[model samples]
Target: MKKHSKIIIFILVLSYLLSGTAFSADIPDDSNVEIVSDEVSAERYARCYDERNYEREFAPGQVFITLKSTTPIVEDYGVLFSEVDVDYVKVISEKFIVIHLVEKTRDSVIDAIDELKDSEYVKFAEPNYRVYSGEAVVPNDEDYNLMNTWHLQITEADEAWNYSTGSSDVTVGVIDSGVSPVADLVANIDYERGINFLDETEPPIDIYNHGTPVAGIIGAVGNNGIGISGVCWNATIVPLKIYDTTNREYYVTGIVEGLIAATAMNLDIVNISYSSLTGDGMLEAIQNYNGLVVVSAGNNNTDLNYNTFYPAALSDECDNMIVVGGSTPYDYRYDLTEQGSNYGDCEVHLFAPGAWIYTTCADGSYRFMTGTSFAAPMVTGAAALVLSYHPDYTTAQVKEAILNSVDQVNALTDLCITGGRLNVKNALLYTPISCGDLNYDWRISNVDVIALARYLENVLELTEHQLSMADMNGDSVVDNTDLDLLAMMVV
Candidate 1:
């Protein structure tokens, strides 16, 4: 009898473990549960689609359900609606599940969802929403000459190159249609590390021919003597394809997924050239990202403050976000080409050359494209250069450097917050200085004189900015002569 009792106790314990403690309590009867209308679920689904203005049809006979985090795996969840003819599709995440109802039972999808919501194991249920990309227009200019890359000179990229041509340690995530490994980008982009979310495990090819040029503008090979130089010649590009060609539009879900993936890779900078009126998911993901995000203020030719666009409007909340507007080669804020650029004192932060911008295109060739899409990459490249120089700089610091170093333009006074155009030269040369403080102790004393003497004697290496500070005579050269002056001043 004693042996039989022990055996029974062990069997009960094993059953509890295997059944996920199912024996602890009985499954609740959902028949008495309140039934909620499908409208609640549809509203949540519509928000994900951003289809408030347009009439959209929900995926027929499909629904998405999320299980509570604490809920343990159970095979019965799949067949919860088996009697109703609904079938479990697959699991999207640990807590999210997809389900499909047969065509004959299409009207029963909502009823199945209501039943699932009433279950104790389910967290919530909603319909699978469809999303599409915003419209991107690029005007063609046939007079494409090598001199079409005048925007680079206007932004002082040529001069900034002397300080830093970007570092291999810096990676810029280009989330767009897709980026092809053109000849000019072969050496600059990290093709092996890139991803195509549109089609899992496939190379991100530029079918729409938009991402390649953007990538070229950001990090095409420099001094190759074959094509125009990119802003950051050495920065690595991580192409993330999110657009779906089948729909001919970018989906909000895809954009959010791309942003999350880029954040996971811990990229130094992310460039988003597309603009939409709704993208709360994208905004949320960006706010949580640790790196800087450069976005385009749409080419809609309107003030974004009143006609707000997302990602650009997200700047109001995300400190790491930089919203770029278009500027003309003549440095005019409201020129013919820039008239279509969106602006707002609080929304749009800075301007860069966007008209007649020359960059690498698909098929291993170069072309002239015009849009705010082309301008955002310039800032992306500049931010990459700054990070290449100071990898330890935080996102906020990099943003401040870019915004504060702009060359103030009067025409941009009421249009943009900075009221100026991007100046990579100024950003590269920005250094907080303290005169007569060679040791950076924030004090001028005999210790500074000794430090200056050591630096001049080549016994100690000083940074370029530090060396400039040691040049107390302001001759732009640090030598023993300056050491003498420092000693006299200290005495």
Candidate 2:
């Protein structure tokens, strides 16, 4: 009886399909057609559809599709799209095609994709998703000038200055367009030699006006009273130009060569404000170098947990790399930074001020720019400060100090790995505690014993490194037994 009932229900469903009376929810309102698919393919299609926040439709009557095929598509393949009601098709690449739909079928992008996927010649089919710059915030910093740099005040750069303004020995490689010899930049320091991989010159030129500001943020001379101060006042700036003005784009070969040049120079910090889908030779160069590479998390305002971006996405593969996201001055009170900044709990390591940043321009002037591009140099400058203080510190130790010293903020939770923003003062003040130096004075003494006892009694707070040092017995706990051993060592 149950089998008979099931057969009857199936017949009723088949009747609805044959009659074309039952409408499919999968069919969009504008398009009356639906693509039939297996359950697994349907779920995959739905997931992909939900991932994009489509602001608007593509150009009318046109859609882009990427296809993988078992056999090379012949010149006669134009007939394939004609069968699906697509009038014209252009081959973008061996794997990419642009379909021009007839006016009536313009809105049936999904239907066309479904039809193409069902073909035996095609292995897979998907839309060519559009990508945008992640930068969004544009707050005016006119009220706060060089005398009172608001970003410096918020990050407590003054307090950090008490420890170290920056060392001339620390060199920062600005891996962007190129640096300019603007009066504010050149008057204080000579034009340091740098490589222009785009044009193959000794001193890179700033034609596009992007790299100058990034360089200014990293190491513009401070206290000259003429213009703004940078994070590191005395650090050397090396311009490794990779952006090509002719094409108005950054090629992978130029980027790879720029990284190789920077690595060869053994720069203390390499600041990359841009991102690419592929890392290629860049990741290997960074790994081979002894210094740290600070990269922007990109200003796309998307969740990187699922959508991977390069260099920033390669954080796990390279320990010397730090992926930074953008935050606003109001991030502490309210996360009012640019909405376009890309973030991931695992991919992005930290956040810094990126909106309306006032820095050097190409024409010996200053202006405000916004992007993860601007935000990356802040952390790069901070790393420079750390290196200036401890020039001998290993790449891992320097990275540790910067990561551990961030100012914890509730607003950045789950957006970055550190769950905090850059705090230059805290980072500069942080001195990695040696195994037995519980007091963190760079030496083992009776004071360490006293401090350890207070910590055990819950009267004092201990930093992570301090707590590790307090575990004198090497059992990974700060217990009374460890306290006894600490007292013995003190004696």
Candidate 3:
């Protein structure tokens, strides 16, 4: 044989022994949770029984009284109405008793409901707002149209929906200020349950359009195709209003109860774009809970290099939750994003376009808003698309696909741990990263040649998959040709 040809043969043989496959643990069995998208526009806002529409769908800001049970009884409205002033009492549904309270207070309403502890009747009483704190607030029309100070790019909205139309049954819990059902942006929303923890009543009227706009960004119904599309156009959004604008206090217990309810409902994702430092219990509950919870990094622009803000960006002990930071449209650092965006060598996870995101609002209107609040639902919507296809993926796995497969950013590597922004297009392209380097230093000795021979002959135990890095020829398979080529090149 010619000297070069012999060298080629020798190199090819040596290459086969060096290439090896790297694999992570396979997906766990219980990870296949399906996305619920078929019921996107079902009787989302109808009365519990689907019988008739109430005069006006209850909004988050409105106050009310909820009786303990659904049984027909005209007892003295005294126990329920004594502590707080009663505006009007009406039976909106069989199971829910409505009391229009004059005062929306925790002490007053809880005291009124507490008085009934001995009565064997009224179940629970609370104020309600459609939006909760830690939930994303949708910016209004002018705000939406304003140039995003973060310089984040708004890709054609349709590009996202092309991947997966969205799962109808998957419920996205909007825990922000509150939302109004009449907004065209969220016109097709499915309100599974509304709680007015503010005044302890049934009707939840959104005083602020914050929650409504966030809801539009995550799950605005599509193909009706009238308004801008949400990340998950076909999913159900459970509006949980838990904020009080008066004192700027968001009840932590209300958040805990919201997550507790979402846990019971088996919601696929909870979008909390709002945050405060006070709610550790609620944050812990969300972290500890088994379902998927996506939270904003926070809007506070303080230095976060030392410590993270709250609930959404909590530690990995609650692995099912994803903490998202905000990115500008251009994928550069945005000062508007909470300075607390980065974590100290911890998983602050992914970033999304949150500067001045535009979406639907209450009262059949549209608007724009900024904050990490808007950024989170973008990930939630993308995760919904992935879950729709890979329903078997656990919350952790889904989070992995998203966090691992994000589009790498330019200068923000220190800001974002994954070093990328959330890109659905890139996420679906992910395969496990490989680590094998079989052909790196292998010599063309007789024994090494024999190992290669055995590997190809199937005599020695060889991994079924091989690293592409070792595939010198660029073909996917790593074999004798690669080994011989490497040996000859060196010899």
Candidate 4:
């Protein structure tokens, strides 16, 4: 999913009554968003297909409503359907339902949803939004070889595998078109749990080809004399297809449904290799998710500091989210005139090798692809590897481990918050030290106290990672409170 190519609803939240808990969300209504596209590059990146309008929109006449636990669905809530002029009611989950109003116009749907949301029986109501994958297609010319995969070598995933090759217990949900049963990927997928949210009756298959490489990048089998190795040599990939066959794109409602499915399926991480404008529903859903949600920084080549992009841009509010941008083999951001990686010192989290990436195609073959879409899975695989080694680690620990240990590069200094490329080994072996531990040692002592005092007084300089460690109370600052905490710990 390049820049505006693919739009993904926040697939982190969408759970209703999993383990008998409350419900929350992410979704869209086309009228609420403006699909920003790089007109010059939109055609340039449309390699596999003809150029088409990639404007974002939602499925018409569809309204997603969450029923309060007390409101049973036995009689369609009695008068609620008739009051809102609902044409039909479809069950999305135990507590979620899709209501189709008789009038299919945008105004009618929004107006009807507004009424439904005010009802005490309804917890929330939102429009069903749509998204698409904007990928840059290239010919199947490159002969992919596992050992020669530079993405693996550069990220040091090859070395990380030496310690742990990922775990079967950890599951990664790929929310995209879908993932085909390719040779390198078949053995790593959990077929029973995979589903097509766009059309629940059908199996989730990669008919559009965008998700295959993303999944392959995360967990393609290694040492099998196969095409390419994923970040994790061993892991489970759950195909959660949100593509709308009717429109040849993704429905925000479908992606939100996919997120719920992921939560119910107990997935540890979800990879959304796409971008779109933020939606209220998607934002709330991602915030409620308990696991890590990795997203692409989009391929618009715009600075996210000024522009707004969904899921990725919501990283500040969602702790579990890790937004990624694209980098190149030359150790520089893949910034092109019309299309490239979206960069921001605030919104975007880090960079990954997304250009000229060779991975699996939807047709069970291999090809070279580009976009922030491919960059996300590298981090997904790294997160899976960390979990495979330390299954007990929480999302915060996992995120900190990855963010605090990037391979700092000169070229990435100002592009993103963490101006460095991913280092799989560093992340896999990372164990975040205590906040007061100035030295690498786990203990806080007089030596640490001196370092902190000097740094606070401007007599010394601390790396970004150390500065985080010194902020004892997690208030995003190092002041008197932190000093007190450090002193108490040292004593």
Candidate 5:
């Protein structure tokens, strides 16, 4: 195995050295990357895609309102709506209430909010934000997409779908080798506003076929009989064709451009399934973007604590970014199938199944890929589903929902900070966070164990969510056994 690795590395180095394109040892930016071609393949016409963020949609005549704490919760908003001369929709959650006015205009929502602001019943109000895909439900395309999609079962995404299939309101940008409008993926993509940084004359179609699978994993129109459903069944998939050199150049310009465009679009989430060294252009663009960004920790088996892969390394600087490493179907941090997934305490944040993973193909079929590239989209999809449940959640909260809910495993114990693999159902549970986070800090550690001990002794108070989290054994009671489990986790 070592000889094979040395031979492979030697070959790669020789090829690059001969081509005069060997990556610099000084930094990992793609300035010196060698180009292959800019021509795009005519695999098929277009299919899936929607420009949601481009033409931001709002629910007409509907306003989302949160009542003051002092006011009583109105189960029946009939009287209140009658008084305000508006119709009541349904209670979204304790965070927000939806009400539809007779007048159907963006102005009506503003006017309604203005009128209700004075009412003691109203604490704050805004338009019921809508876009291409906001509704959530379980999908029927599970059988078709699940043929080789064991990663979903590994992370419990199939169960999480019961909570939210995904929302069209959310837009996730796939800035990789571009995407193809394949039959399975065509139904969920938004083609109206795609950006091809490599070529302007042609659409951002897949010539290398990397982003198609990533996009399919995130939002491939659930229940459309598209063969596979994405993590976000209804969310819009915007193809941000920044770099089509997944197999060739490890460039940074296209990635930088994609980040800029995503920031301008105010995209909800983005998936960058590549790895490069940290540089100014990448850091500046990442820091500037307010939305959540999920990036792949390179497929190399090196520890990122010392090497520091770009966007994955940037996770320390940007709380909104999630650095995903590849795991196996059995949740091993290193997949022997290819170069093992990268890891680090400070860089690679978490692991998802990436070994021999089956997903949508560029030619509108399904294929298997093994790398952090494929794994990153699983995290991106999980993040999208969390946002679909609560669009109001901050990037920090959404990030915690995914990170804190990881399933602790021995293989990942020393590989990454989380020391666990993705658990989609656990992540979707509660408001989100902490395998045993009794203190409700969105993290599980000694502090939580201490809090749990105190709670057992009747010395601390915990919220309903915290109590649920404290039930480490799922026996419906927070006992010393649960406390013991929490303490073991901290250690």
Candidate 6:
């Protein structure tokens, strides 16, 4: 048959097989079929078509070993193994089988399954949908703008005088398709430390142009009258490419290895613009690493009610990962913004701008791409600034401050997990608890009375070396006056 004829026949057969009430009926008891966990069972997982509103909890994904069998080649079976998004499929042995399904919509998967059900030739169909890239999107510009966008005007003097100007001395790891050392934009940092987890070669080469753009957003060289300015002009970017230039094959181990290598370099932040539908345990180990893991929530347009995807927006196992979802250039509600992003009851925190963005590309070019992949680095830039201002803060404290200081408009508040977009200004304004500013921050407690007694008695002067932190009253000197306020706190 001609190629077009074959495709038409395939479609017709699929339609005929799937159009009937096969799924509508109760699964046959004599069918000898078994229902597996939602993660392993692809049929139960529905795609999130609506991006504007998200669905609640359904089922959490899992990893398991299952029996596999070769599907006999027969026209009777409505299904035929095809490759579009599929890399390859093979049978491990007679009793064990593995097949890589084509990457398509939930509708395609369901259609394939419906066709498979009536076929006596094939035993079963299980999904391996867990493959992912560690990426996510932020909200739109309007959503982020509502949070008040603060632009830093860094003059030559500012760059020289500012201790940590625009993420200087910080290394933001770009773990994506290798970065092109576009000398003009990035200054071509060190490539020796980077590893090609996806292709296993020198990591910094930009074969696909994805990583370079991401790098530009985080730390593009600025102020040389360049094409565009990066969020962090002075920060040193560590390019850790995790994707292949040709035929992007996302591997979990590559991300794990990248995280391990980046952490070993003591990187301040690792930006992952990739995500998968399946969880990789190695990623959890990577998350436990010392550096921060910032991931893209994805552009899949499905509710992340459960941890269905891996890495970025979904890998709940990776403890320290900040899963970022997208918002548009403006906070307009639309279906495209709805799906592929995930949320948790309390965990999925922080949102940034992701839609309709233009940025620099590899080879000194510029392009506009859409996805959660781009959204993450903006926050990564904010993080660099936070570290620049407050070098004493820990990773956990930084995460809290970032989440707490977001722009909380109704559009983002309802859609985003943290209920706001990142605010660089508020984050900069946030102050750690004063050692002894009890009047401004006195939590009513019994200890306040004891501390107050000492203050009044003169036995414990608030300004004394040990009691200086207890100065609730302003006055540069901590004295009995502050203790009176502490006593009031107890009462």
- For model 4, give the RMSD to the true fold: 24.1
Please give, for residues 1-491, the per-residue lDDT of candidate 5 as tens digits: 12353245335433433463011112223333222223332111011111122123577778888877766666687466554657556777765678877788877876776678777678777677653331223456644533355667657787777666788888888888788988777766777767888776778888687889888888776677547677777788889887645455547988999999999988888899988765557888987888899999998889988886777777765657888899865556754654788898667778988776667888877766778998899999998888887776667678887887898878788887788888877776545434575443355555666566666667667766567767766677777666655555554
How would you encode candidate 3's per-residue C-alpha lDDT over 303-410 as one tens digit per residue?
354555667435444557777777654555446432534332254566787755657766666555667778888888777766664565566556766776766666
Tens digits of per-residue lDDT for model 1 on 325-402?
987665555345445888888788899877667788988877767788888998998898877766756675577668
lDDT of 2 at 374: 84
Alpha-carbon TM-score of each model against the true structure: 0.58, 0.59, 0.55, 0.62, 0.62, 0.54
Model 2 lDDT tens row, 1-491: 13353245335433433464011112113132122222232332231122222222245555576566565677855676565766777888888777777753434665666677767656665554444332222213332343235466556665677656788888888888888898667642334558877667456879899999998888777776667778887888888888888889987677667678777777778888888877766778767877888999987788788887777877776768888888765553122354578887778888887766778999878876778888889999999988887776666556767887887767798888888888887776565434455533334566666666666657667767567766755666678766655555443
lDDT of 6 at 18: 50
- Tens-digit lDDT track for model 6 on 1-491? 13353245335433433565001212223232221112222221122111111111111121111332445544322134331233344555444344444544444444444554444434654343443232211222221221122112111112211323455566777777777777545573557666676556445677777888777666666555545555665677777777755666667766777788887888877888877766566555565577667887766765555445667543344435677776553332223634544443233465666643446677777655456777777677667666666665656445655666666646656555567666554564454333332221113344444544544555433334224445554354555555444434343
What lDDT score goes with residue 207 in model 3? 71
By TM-score, the better pick of 5 and 6 is 5
What's the C-alpha lDDT at position 195 in model 6? 67
Better of 1 and 4 by TM-score: 4
Q: lDDT of model 4 at residue 100? A: 80
- For model 1, the stretches where C-alpha displacement exceeds 4 angstroms are 1-146, 334-339, 432-491
Highest lDDT against the true fold, candidate = 4
Tens-digit lDDT track of model 4 for 70-142: 8866756436666688787887776988888788877776678657766877887777765323221111223
Ten contiguous residues minimizing lDDT sum, candidate 3: 47-56
Overall lDDT per candidate, in order of appearance:
0.71, 0.68, 0.55, 0.74, 0.71, 0.52
lDDT of 6: 0.52
Off by over 4 Å in 3: 1-157, 183-188, 245-248, 336-347, 428-491
